[model samples]
Target: MTEAIASEAASNPGMQMKYKIVFLGDQSVGKTSIILRFTSDSFDVKYQATIGIDFLTKTVYVDDKMVRLQLWDTAGQERFRSLIPSYINDSQVGVVCYDITSRQSFENVKSWVEQARQ
Candidate 1:
Protein backbone atom coordinates (compact mmCIF):
# COMPACT_ATOMS: atom_id res chain seq x y z
CA MET A 1 0.00 0.00 0.00
CA THR A 2 2.82 2.40 0.85
CA GLU A 3 4.63 1.66 -2.37
CA ALA A 4 1.46 2.23 -4.33
CA ILE A 5 0.82 5.54 -2.67
CA ALA A 6 4.42 6.60 -3.15
CA SER A 7 4.12 5.72 -6.81
CA GLU A 8 0.94 7.72 -7.14
CA ALA A 9 2.59 10.64 -5.38
CA ALA A 10 5.55 10.41 -7.71
CA SER A 11 3.33 10.50 -10.76
CA ASN A 12 1.29 13.45 -9.56
CA PRO A 13 2.76 16.86 -10.28
CA GLY A 14 -0.12 18.65 -8.58
CA MET A 15 0.65 17.23 -5.12
CA GLN A 16 2.62 20.09 -3.72
CA MET A 17 3.40 20.41 -0.01
CA LYS A 18 3.52 23.45 2.24
CA TYR A 19 6.15 21.85 4.50
CA LYS A 20 8.26 18.73 4.82
CA ILE A 21 10.99 17.60 7.22
CA VAL A 22 13.56 14.84 7.66
CA PHE A 23 15.53 13.36 10.55
CA LEU A 24 18.90 11.63 10.18
CA GLY A 25 21.40 10.07 12.56
CA ASP A 26 23.49 6.98 13.30
CA GLN A 27 22.10 3.75 14.72
CA SER A 28 21.10 3.75 18.43
CA VAL A 29 21.30 7.51 18.48
CA GLY A 30 17.59 7.91 19.23
CA LYS A 31 16.22 9.32 15.96
CA THR A 32 12.97 7.42 16.19
CA SER A 33 12.61 8.18 19.89
CA ILE A 34 12.93 11.88 19.22
CA ILE A 35 10.39 11.74 16.41
CA LEU A 36 7.99 9.85 18.64
CA ARG A 37 8.37 12.56 21.21
CA PHE A 38 7.68 15.30 18.72
CA THR A 39 4.72 13.53 17.19
CA SER A 40 3.11 12.17 20.35
CA ASP A 41 4.98 13.66 23.26
CA SER A 42 5.90 10.19 24.44
CA PHE A 43 8.82 7.79 24.25
CA ASP A 44 9.36 4.04 24.42
CA VAL A 45 12.18 2.51 26.44
CA LYS A 46 12.28 -0.67 24.38
CA TYR A 47 15.19 -0.90 21.97
CA GLN A 48 13.84 -2.40 18.77
CA ALA A 49 15.62 -0.58 15.97
CA THR A 50 13.97 1.03 12.98
CA ILE A 51 14.54 -1.28 10.02
CA GLY A 52 14.71 1.13 7.07
CA ILE A 53 12.70 4.33 7.27
CA ASP A 54 9.44 5.53 8.75
CA PHE A 55 7.22 8.51 8.11
CA LEU A 56 4.80 10.64 10.11
CA THR A 57 2.52 13.48 9.21
CA LYS A 58 1.13 16.29 11.33
CA THR A 59 -0.76 19.47 10.65
CA VAL A 60 0.11 22.76 12.29
CA TYR A 61 -0.86 26.38 12.03
CA VAL A 62 1.78 28.65 10.59
CA ASP A 63 0.97 32.32 11.04
CA ASP A 64 -2.74 31.60 10.69
CA LYS A 65 -2.25 29.30 7.70
CA MET A 66 -2.64 25.56 8.04
CA VAL A 67 0.41 23.56 6.99
CA ARG A 68 1.22 19.90 7.10
CA LEU A 69 4.52 18.21 7.80
CA GLN A 70 5.72 15.20 5.88
CA LEU A 71 8.27 13.93 8.38
CA TRP A 72 10.74 11.33 7.17
CA ASP A 73 12.79 9.31 9.62
CA THR A 74 15.71 7.49 8.02
CA ALA A 75 17.41 4.41 9.37
CA GLY A 76 20.63 5.13 11.24
CA GLN A 77 23.33 2.67 10.30
CA GLU A 78 26.21 2.40 7.83
CA ARG A 79 24.31 0.07 5.52
CA PHE A 80 21.21 2.26 5.59
CA ARG A 81 22.86 5.41 4.26
CA SER A 82 22.11 4.34 0.73
CA LEU A 83 18.38 4.48 1.49
CA ILE A 84 18.54 8.08 2.68
CA PRO A 85 19.00 9.93 -0.62
CA SER A 86 15.42 9.52 -1.76
CA TYR A 87 13.98 10.28 1.68
CA ILE A 88 15.75 13.58 2.07
CA ASN A 89 15.58 14.68 -1.53
CA ASP A 90 12.44 16.79 -1.24
CA SER A 91 12.59 17.68 2.46
CA GLN A 92 12.56 21.37 3.32
CA VAL A 93 14.10 21.03 6.81
CA GLY A 94 16.61 18.56 8.21
CA VAL A 95 17.18 17.41 11.79
CA VAL A 96 20.27 15.51 12.91
CA CYS A 97 20.22 13.80 16.34
CA TYR A 98 22.82 12.27 18.63
CA ASP A 99 22.67 10.94 22.17
CA ILE A 100 23.58 13.67 24.61
CA THR A 101 25.86 11.61 26.85
CA SER A 102 27.42 9.31 24.31
CA ARG A 103 30.74 10.54 22.95
CA GLN A 104 30.75 8.31 19.89
CA SER A 105 27.18 9.21 19.11
CA PHE A 106 28.08 12.86 19.37
CA GLU A 107 31.03 12.42 17.02
CA ASN A 108 28.95 10.48 14.55
CA VAL A 109 26.65 13.46 14.20
CA LYS A 110 29.09 15.02 11.74
CA SER A 111 28.87 12.06 9.39
CA TRP A 112 25.09 12.00 9.67
CA VAL A 113 24.92 15.74 8.99
CA GLU A 114 27.13 15.33 5.92
CA GLN A 115 25.08 12.42 4.64
CA ALA A 116 21.84 14.32 5.19
CA ARG A 117 23.29 17.27 3.29
CA GLN A 118 23.97 15.01 0.33
Candidate 2:
Protein backbone atom coordinates (compact mmCIF):
# COMPACT_ATOMS: atom_id res chain seq x y z
CA MET A 1 0.00 0.00 0.00
CA THR A 2 2.87 2.35 0.72
CA GLU A 3 4.34 1.42 -2.63
CA ALA A 4 1.09 2.34 -4.33
CA ILE A 5 1.17 5.64 -2.49
CA ALA A 6 4.75 6.27 -3.56
CA SER A 7 3.97 5.42 -7.17
CA GLU A 8 0.91 7.65 -7.13
CA ALA A 9 2.89 10.51 -5.65
CA ALA A 10 5.66 9.98 -8.19
CA SER A 11 3.21 10.29 -11.05
CA ASN A 12 1.31 13.26 -9.62
CA PRO A 13 3.02 15.07 -6.81
CA GLY A 14 0.09 17.44 -6.52
CA MET A 15 -1.94 14.81 -4.72
CA GLN A 16 0.58 14.96 -1.91
CA MET A 17 -0.73 18.42 -1.15
CA LYS A 18 -3.34 18.45 1.62
CA TYR A 19 -6.86 18.02 0.43
CA LYS A 20 -10.42 17.27 1.50
CA ILE A 21 -11.26 14.92 -1.33
CA VAL A 22 -14.58 14.13 -2.92
CA PHE A 23 -15.33 11.55 -5.60
CA LEU A 24 -17.75 12.60 -8.30
CA GLY A 25 -18.71 10.61 -11.36
CA ASP A 26 -21.43 8.72 -13.18
CA GLN A 27 -23.09 5.59 -11.72
CA SER A 28 -21.06 2.37 -11.62
CA VAL A 29 -17.91 4.10 -12.79
CA GLY A 30 -15.78 2.54 -10.04
CA LYS A 31 -15.62 5.66 -7.89
CA THR A 32 -16.52 3.63 -4.81
CA SER A 33 -14.16 0.87 -5.92
CA ILE A 34 -11.32 3.34 -6.08
CA ILE A 35 -12.06 4.61 -2.57
CA LEU A 36 -12.42 1.09 -1.19
CA ARG A 37 -9.14 0.13 -2.82
CA PHE A 38 -7.40 3.11 -1.25
CA THR A 39 -9.04 2.77 2.13
CA SER A 40 -9.55 -0.97 2.66
CA ASP A 41 -7.33 -2.58 0.02
CA SER A 42 -10.26 -4.72 -0.98
CA PHE A 43 -12.71 -4.90 -3.87
CA ASP A 44 -16.06 -6.51 -4.48
CA VAL A 45 -17.40 -7.50 -7.90
CA LYS A 46 -21.02 -7.16 -6.95
CA TYR A 47 -22.67 -3.87 -7.83
CA GLN A 48 -24.36 -2.05 -4.99
CA ALA A 49 -25.65 1.48 -5.35
CA THR A 50 -24.87 4.26 -2.90
CA ILE A 51 -27.90 5.78 -1.23
CA GLY A 52 -26.97 9.47 -0.81
CA ILE A 53 -23.35 9.86 0.28
CA ASP A 54 -20.66 7.88 1.96
CA PHE A 55 -17.71 9.32 3.89
CA LEU A 56 -14.26 8.04 4.80
CA THR A 57 -10.99 9.50 6.00
CA LYS A 58 -7.36 8.40 5.78
CA THR A 59 -4.14 10.14 6.70
CA VAL A 60 -1.18 9.87 4.36
CA TYR A 61 2.28 10.67 5.61
CA VAL A 62 3.90 13.23 3.36
CA ASP A 63 7.45 14.31 4.05
CA ASP A 64 7.24 13.94 7.79
CA LYS A 65 3.89 15.72 7.81
CA MET A 66 0.54 14.02 8.08
CA VAL A 67 -1.82 14.98 5.30
CA ARG A 68 -5.39 13.95 5.94
CA LEU A 69 -7.85 13.16 3.20
CA GLN A 70 -11.53 13.38 4.03
CA LEU A 71 -13.06 11.34 1.22
CA TRP A 72 -16.73 11.56 0.35
CA ASP A 73 -18.29 9.13 -2.09
CA THR A 74 -21.43 10.69 -3.47
CA ALA A 75 -24.27 8.87 -5.21
CA GLY A 76 -24.19 9.04 -9.00
CA GLN A 77 -27.92 8.78 -9.49
CA GLU A 78 -29.99 11.86 -10.40
CA ARG A 79 -32.27 11.38 -7.45
CA PHE A 80 -29.30 11.92 -5.18
CA ARG A 81 -28.27 15.22 -6.70
CA SER A 82 -30.07 17.12 -3.99
CA LEU A 83 -27.86 15.50 -1.43
CA ILE A 84 -24.60 16.32 -3.21
CA PRO A 85 -24.29 20.03 -2.52
CA SER A 86 -23.84 19.47 1.19
CA TYR A 87 -20.92 17.16 0.57
CA ILE A 88 -19.19 19.58 -1.76
CA ASN A 89 -18.79 22.27 0.83
CA ASP A 90 -15.26 22.55 2.25
CA SER A 91 -13.98 20.00 -0.29
CA GLN A 92 -10.52 20.85 -1.52
CA VAL A 93 -10.33 18.25 -4.28
CA GLY A 94 -12.80 16.38 -6.45
CA VAL A 95 -12.24 13.24 -8.57
CA VAL A 96 -14.51 12.61 -11.48
CA CYS A 97 -14.40 9.19 -13.16
CA TYR A 98 -16.33 7.30 -15.82
CA ASP A 99 -16.09 3.78 -17.21
CA ILE A 100 -14.30 3.49 -20.54
CA THR A 101 -17.03 1.33 -22.08
CA SER A 102 -19.87 3.65 -21.14
CA ARG A 103 -20.06 6.54 -23.57
CA GLN A 104 -23.08 8.12 -21.98
CA SER A 105 -21.49 7.98 -18.59
CA PHE A 106 -18.36 9.58 -19.96
CA GLU A 107 -20.37 12.35 -21.56
CA ASN A 108 -22.23 13.05 -18.36
CA VAL A 109 -19.09 13.73 -16.38
CA LYS A 110 -19.32 17.37 -17.40
CA SER A 111 -22.62 17.78 -15.63
CA TRP A 112 -21.25 16.16 -12.55
CA VAL A 113 -18.33 18.55 -12.61
CA GLU A 114 -20.70 21.43 -13.10
CA GLN A 115 -22.82 20.31 -10.20
CA ALA A 116 -19.79 20.18 -7.97
CA ARG A 117 -18.86 23.70 -8.98
CA GLN A 118 -22.25 24.82 -7.72
Candidate 3:
Protein backbone atom coordinates (compact mmCIF):
# COMPACT_ATOMS: atom_id res chain seq x y z
CA MET A 1 0.00 0.00 0.00
CA THR A 2 2.96 2.30 0.57
CA GLU A 3 4.01 2.17 -3.05
CA ALA A 4 0.39 2.33 -4.09
CA ILE A 5 -0.31 5.63 -2.31
CA ALA A 6 3.15 7.13 -2.45
CA SER A 7 2.31 9.42 -5.33
CA GLU A 8 -0.82 10.66 -3.59
CA ALA A 9 1.15 11.47 -0.46
CA ALA A 10 3.68 13.63 -2.17
CA SER A 11 4.55 15.95 0.67
CA ASN A 12 7.63 17.07 2.58
CA PRO A 13 8.82 15.22 5.70
CA GLY A 14 7.89 17.94 8.14
CA MET A 15 5.37 16.01 10.26
CA GLN A 16 3.20 12.93 10.06
CA MET A 17 0.19 13.27 7.76
CA LYS A 18 -3.07 11.31 7.95
CA TYR A 19 -5.36 9.95 5.28
CA LYS A 20 -8.71 8.22 5.51
CA ILE A 21 -9.18 5.32 3.12
CA VAL A 22 -12.72 4.01 3.28
CA PHE A 23 -13.56 0.56 1.92
CA LEU A 24 -17.00 0.24 0.34
CA GLY A 25 -18.65 -2.77 -1.25
CA ASP A 26 -21.39 -5.33 -0.84
CA GLN A 27 -21.44 -8.05 1.83
CA SER A 28 -18.72 -10.72 1.73
CA VAL A 29 -16.82 -9.02 -1.07
CA GLY A 30 -13.50 -9.00 0.84
CA LYS A 31 -13.29 -5.30 1.69
CA THR A 32 -11.74 -6.11 5.05
CA SER A 33 -9.53 -8.72 3.46
CA ILE A 34 -7.77 -6.01 1.47
CA ILE A 35 -7.14 -3.93 4.57
CA LEU A 36 -5.90 -6.91 6.58
CA ARG A 37 -3.60 -7.93 3.78
CA PHE A 38 -2.15 -4.44 3.58
CA THR A 39 -1.73 -3.76 7.29
CA SER A 40 -0.82 -7.20 8.59
CA ASP A 41 0.49 -8.96 5.51
CA SER A 42 -2.01 -11.78 6.19
CA PHE A 43 -5.38 -12.93 4.87
CA ASP A 44 -8.42 -14.56 6.49
CA VAL A 45 -10.22 -17.37 4.71
CA LYS A 46 -13.33 -17.24 6.89
CA TYR A 47 -16.11 -14.80 6.10
CA GLN A 48 -16.67 -12.39 8.97
CA ALA A 49 -19.06 -9.56 8.27
CA THR A 50 -17.94 -6.20 9.45
CA ILE A 51 -20.36 -4.68 11.96
CA GLY A 52 -20.68 -0.93 11.52
CA ILE A 53 -17.14 0.17 10.70
CA ASP A 54 -13.74 -1.04 11.85
CA PHE A 55 -10.99 1.54 12.03
CA LEU A 56 -7.35 0.55 11.68
CA THR A 57 -4.22 2.63 11.34
CA LYS A 58 -0.87 1.97 9.68
CA THR A 59 2.12 4.26 9.23
CA VAL A 60 4.66 4.07 6.44
CA TYR A 61 7.13 6.18 4.57
CA VAL A 62 5.72 7.94 1.53
CA ASP A 63 7.88 10.36 -0.39
CA ASP A 64 10.15 10.73 2.62
CA LYS A 65 7.17 11.64 4.79
CA MET A 66 5.60 9.62 7.58
CA VAL A 67 2.16 8.91 6.16
CA ARG A 68 -0.54 7.59 8.47
CA LEU A 69 -3.24 5.64 6.72
CA GLN A 70 -6.57 5.47 8.50
CA LEU A 71 -8.07 2.38 6.96
CA TRP A 72 -11.85 2.27 7.37
CA ASP A 73 -13.40 -1.15 6.98
CA THR A 74 -17.05 -0.36 6.38
CA ALA A 75 -20.00 -2.70 6.85
CA GLY A 76 -21.35 -3.97 3.55
CA GLN A 77 -24.76 -5.09 4.72
CA GLU A 78 -27.72 -3.11 3.38
CA ARG A 79 -28.71 -2.27 6.92
CA PHE A 80 -25.48 -0.34 7.36
CA ARG A 81 -25.41 1.40 4.01
CA SER A 82 -27.07 4.42 5.53
CA LEU A 83 -24.02 5.10 7.64
CA ILE A 84 -21.52 5.06 4.80
CA PRO A 85 -21.94 8.60 3.54
CA SER A 86 -21.11 10.14 6.90
CA TYR A 87 -17.72 8.49 6.90
CA ILE A 88 -17.22 8.94 3.18
CA ASN A 89 -17.68 12.66 3.62
CA ASP A 90 -14.02 13.18 4.45
CA SER A 91 -12.30 10.19 2.94
CA GLN A 92 -9.16 10.64 0.90
CA VAL A 93 -9.86 7.43 -0.98
CA GLY A 94 -12.80 5.05 -1.26
CA VAL A 95 -11.97 1.52 -2.42
CA VAL A 96 -14.97 -0.24 -3.91
CA CYS A 97 -14.47 -4.01 -3.60
CA TYR A 98 -16.46 -6.71 -5.33
CA ASP A 99 -16.36 -10.48 -5.69
CA ILE A 100 -15.48 -11.52 -9.20
CA THR A 101 -17.70 -14.58 -8.85
CA SER A 102 -20.81 -12.64 -7.86
CA ARG A 103 -22.63 -10.78 -10.57
CA GLN A 104 -24.83 -8.79 -8.19
CA SER A 105 -21.83 -7.63 -6.23
CA PHE A 106 -20.20 -6.42 -9.40
CA GLU A 107 -23.36 -4.64 -10.44
CA ASN A 108 -23.61 -2.83 -7.15
CA VAL A 109 -20.17 -1.34 -7.71
CA LYS A 110 -21.79 1.48 -9.65
CA SER A 111 -24.06 2.38 -6.76
CA TRP A 112 -21.14 2.27 -4.35
CA VAL A 113 -19.05 4.40 -6.64
CA GLU A 114 -21.91 6.80 -7.02
CA GLN A 115 -22.25 7.05 -3.29
CA ALA A 116 -18.55 7.77 -2.96
CA ARG A 117 -18.81 10.39 -5.65
CA GLN A 118 -21.44 12.23 -3.68
Candidate 4:
Protein backbone atom coordinates (compact mmCIF):
# COMPACT_ATOMS: atom_id res chain seq x y z
CA MET A 1 0.00 0.00 0.00
CA THR A 2 2.81 2.38 0.77
CA GLU A 3 4.51 1.66 -2.54
CA ALA A 4 1.23 1.80 -4.37
CA ILE A 5 0.37 5.23 -2.97
CA ALA A 6 3.85 6.56 -3.49
CA SER A 7 3.83 5.30 -7.07
CA GLU A 8 0.48 6.95 -7.62
CA ALA A 9 1.98 10.27 -6.61
CA ALA A 10 3.61 10.42 -10.03
CA SER A 11 3.65 14.17 -10.28
CA ASN A 12 7.13 14.16 -8.74
CA PRO A 13 8.22 10.61 -8.38
CA GLY A 14 11.89 11.29 -7.86
CA MET A 15 11.25 14.27 -5.64
CA GLN A 16 8.84 12.51 -3.34
CA MET A 17 8.59 9.19 -1.53
CA LYS A 18 6.44 7.57 1.18
CA TYR A 19 7.13 5.48 4.28
CA LYS A 20 5.05 3.41 6.67
CA ILE A 21 5.72 3.52 10.40
CA VAL A 22 3.93 1.14 12.74
CA PHE A 23 3.44 1.86 16.47
CA LEU A 24 3.35 -1.13 18.81
CA GLY A 25 3.03 -1.76 22.56
CA ASP A 26 0.78 -2.91 25.39
CA GLN A 27 -2.58 -1.32 26.32
CA SER A 28 -2.57 2.31 27.51
CA VAL A 29 1.09 2.61 26.61
CA GLY A 30 0.85 5.94 24.76
CA LYS A 31 1.12 4.74 21.16
CA THR A 32 -1.93 6.77 20.18
CA SER A 33 -0.84 9.72 22.28
CA ILE A 34 2.49 9.92 20.53
CA ILE A 35 0.85 9.73 17.13
CA LEU A 36 -1.73 12.34 18.06
CA ARG A 37 0.88 14.71 19.38
CA PHE A 38 3.04 14.32 16.31
CA THR A 39 0.28 14.64 13.76
CA SER A 40 -2.11 17.10 15.39
CA ASP A 41 0.01 18.89 17.96
CA SER A 42 -2.61 18.15 20.61
CA PHE A 43 -3.29 15.57 23.29
CA ASP A 44 -6.54 14.06 24.54
CA VAL A 45 -7.14 13.38 28.18
CA LYS A 46 -10.02 11.04 27.45
CA TYR A 47 -8.46 7.64 27.19
CA GLN A 48 -9.66 5.38 24.45
CA ALA A 49 -8.30 2.10 23.24
CA THR A 50 -7.70 1.88 19.53
CA ILE A 51 -9.84 -0.77 17.95
CA GLY A 52 -8.18 -2.83 15.22
CA ILE A 53 -5.95 -0.34 13.41
CA ASP A 54 -6.02 3.38 12.80
CA PHE A 55 -4.06 5.16 10.08
CA LEU A 56 -2.89 8.70 9.71
CA THR A 57 -0.64 10.44 7.20
CA LYS A 58 1.56 13.50 7.31
CA THR A 59 3.73 15.08 4.65
CA VAL A 60 6.87 17.03 5.22
CA TYR A 61 9.83 18.36 3.31
CA VAL A 62 13.09 16.51 3.75
CA ASP A 63 16.35 17.32 2.04
CA ASP A 64 14.52 19.49 -0.49
CA LYS A 65 12.13 16.65 -1.25
CA MET A 66 8.64 15.67 -0.20
CA VAL A 67 8.25 12.78 2.22
CA ARG A 68 4.90 11.31 3.17
CA LEU A 69 4.86 9.37 6.41
CA GLN A 70 2.10 6.82 6.74
CA LEU A 71 1.65 6.29 10.44
CA TRP A 72 -0.12 3.09 11.46
CA ASP A 73 -1.76 3.30 14.90
CA THR A 74 -2.32 -0.25 15.94
CA ALA A 75 -4.51 -1.39 18.81
CA GLY A 76 -2.65 -2.65 21.85
CA GLN A 77 -5.37 -5.08 22.79
CA GLU A 78 -4.57 -8.77 22.70
CA ARG A 79 -7.33 -9.50 20.20
CA PHE A 80 -5.71 -7.14 17.73
CA ARG A 81 -2.28 -8.66 18.24
CA SER A 82 -2.91 -11.19 15.50
CA LEU A 83 -3.34 -8.42 12.95
CA ILE A 84 -0.06 -6.64 13.52
CA PRO A 85 2.46 -8.77 11.59
CA SER A 86 1.10 -7.92 8.14
CA TYR A 87 1.42 -4.23 8.96
CA ILE A 88 4.91 -4.80 10.32
CA ASN A 89 5.91 -6.65 7.19
CA ASP A 90 4.89 -3.69 5.05
CA SER A 91 6.26 -0.94 7.28
CA GLN A 92 9.59 0.81 6.95
CA VAL A 93 9.71 1.69 10.66
CA GLY A 94 8.29 0.33 13.93
CA VAL A 95 7.93 2.26 17.19
CA VAL A 96 7.54 0.33 20.43
CA CYS A 97 5.88 2.49 23.09
CA TYR A 98 5.67 1.86 26.83
CA ASP A 99 4.47 3.71 29.90
CA ILE A 100 7.41 4.66 32.10
CA THR A 101 5.38 4.26 35.26
CA SER A 102 4.24 0.74 34.54
CA ARG A 103 6.71 -2.08 34.96
CA GLN A 104 4.56 -4.47 32.98
CA SER A 105 4.35 -2.04 30.11
CA PHE A 106 8.10 -1.59 30.13
CA GLU A 107 8.70 -5.30 30.44
CA ASN A 108 6.41 -5.97 27.49
CA VAL A 109 8.53 -3.76 25.28
CA LYS A 110 10.84 -6.66 24.53
CA SER A 111 8.01 -8.73 23.15
CA TRP A 112 6.79 -5.81 21.10
CA VAL A 113 10.28 -5.29 19.76
CA GLU A 114 10.54 -8.98 18.96
CA GLN A 115 7.34 -8.80 16.97
CA ALA A 116 8.56 -5.78 15.07
CA ARG A 117 11.85 -7.54 14.46
CA GLN A 118 10.05 -10.52 13.01
Q: Each prediction's TM-score against the native?
A: 0.79, 0.82, 0.89, 0.87
Candidate 2 Cα RMSD (Å):
5.9
Report every candidate's CA lDDT. 0.75, 0.82, 0.89, 0.87
- Tens digit of per-residue lDDT, candidate 4, span 28-96: 989999999999898999999999999999986654557889899999999999999999998988989
Where does model 3 exceed 4 Å of error?
A: 1-12
Backbone clash pairs for candidate 2 read none
RMSD after Cα superposition, model 1: 7.9
Candidate 3 per-residue C-alpha lDDT over 1-118 given as tens digits, one digit per residue, 9 for 90 to 100: 6655665556433656788999999999998989999999999898889999998999877667778889999999999989999999998888999999999999999999999998
TM-score, cand. 3 vs. native: 0.89
In candidate 2, what are the lDDT values of residues 1-118, reduced to their tens digit? 4454455566665555446788999889999999999988999999999888998888878544456777899888989989888888888778898999999999998998898899
Runs of candidate 4 with Cα error greater than 4 angstroms are 1-13
Which of the predicted structures, 1 or 3, would earn the higher lDDT when compared with the native?
3
Of the candidates shown, which would achieve the greatest TM-score relative to the real structure?
Answer: 3
Q: How many clashes does the backbone of model 4 have?
A: 0
Give each prediction's root-mean-square deviation over alpha carbons. 7.9, 5.9, 2.3, 4.9
- TM-score of structure candidate 1: 0.79
